[model samples]
Target: MPTETPRPMRRQILTFAVVGVINTATYYGFYLLFLIALPYLGAHVLAFLLSMTGSFFLNARFTYRTRPTWRKFLLFPLTNAANFLITTAGVYVIVGVLHHGSRFAPLGASMAAIPVTFVVSRWIMVPKAGTA
Candidate 1:
């Protein structure tokens, strides 16, 4: 018997996971740098914005196997907005209500947002056939 092939969704999820690791590393590095000068929340926001920019290109090219376009670049933020909102709220709750350390709050918060972000990003980055 032949081994089963992974479904498109499964493949996408795996790819997204790889890209997410890279994006998270980029974001965390920036966050730590900014943390030296800004509040935790401020650092998170700035880092998120910077990472989302890199994420657009990575997701478009590597994750989705799609060409990068001006249109996709502009729309990419919509996918990230959901992630940003969920992670931001989560960070606030964990750090504020749960009394967690600010340094690790964003990482913990981001885990909850990953599934939602993957779905939204796939929808945005993978366009329908014959559609631009």
Candidate 2:
């Protein structure tokens, strides 16, 4: 039997919202640890990479529910790269440039990237693979 395509755009957004929450937690956990362990920039970079992998795996399996493909595998890194830039930039501007270390800045900056990353990861980077 043929496979059904993934859900419509609204469903996609909702699915992404759920996954985004999980990914945000994963990213923040590592971010705080690395922020203390390493240099601010270094920690952000390393933690972002680690969390990106985790998010990709979870997003592939749970959020999008698409088949694994060589294309998706390769594109994951690119998607992460985009996410990293946005995340890192946000972190730096808030923590470094703006010096908004008001306790909220850390979480706020990290949270800021969720929507940006989700849109790219879902619509552009991760291939649908004709669903599962």
Considering every candidate listed, which one attains the maximal lDDT? 1
How far is 97's C-alpha from truth in model 2 (Å)? 1.7
Q: Model 1, stretches more than 4 Å misplaced?
A: 1-6, 129-132
lDDT by residue for model 2 (14-110), tens: 8777877777777677867877868777766776777777777777777777776667766777656666676677877887888777334546666
The lDDT of each candidate is 0.89, 0.69
Alpha carbon RMSD to native, model 1: 3.3
TM-score (C-alpha) between model 1 and the true structure: 0.89
lDDT of 1 by residue, 1-132 (tens): 997746876787888999999999999999999999999899999999999999999888888999989988999999888899999999899988999899999998898889888877877888672253
Instruction: Say which candidate scores most in TM-score.
Output: 1
Q: Which 10 consecutive residues of model 1 have the lowest summed lDDT? A: 123-132
Q: Give RMSD (Å) of candidate 2 vs. truth.
A: 5.7
Q: How many residue pairs clash in each candidate at the backbone level?
A: 0, 0
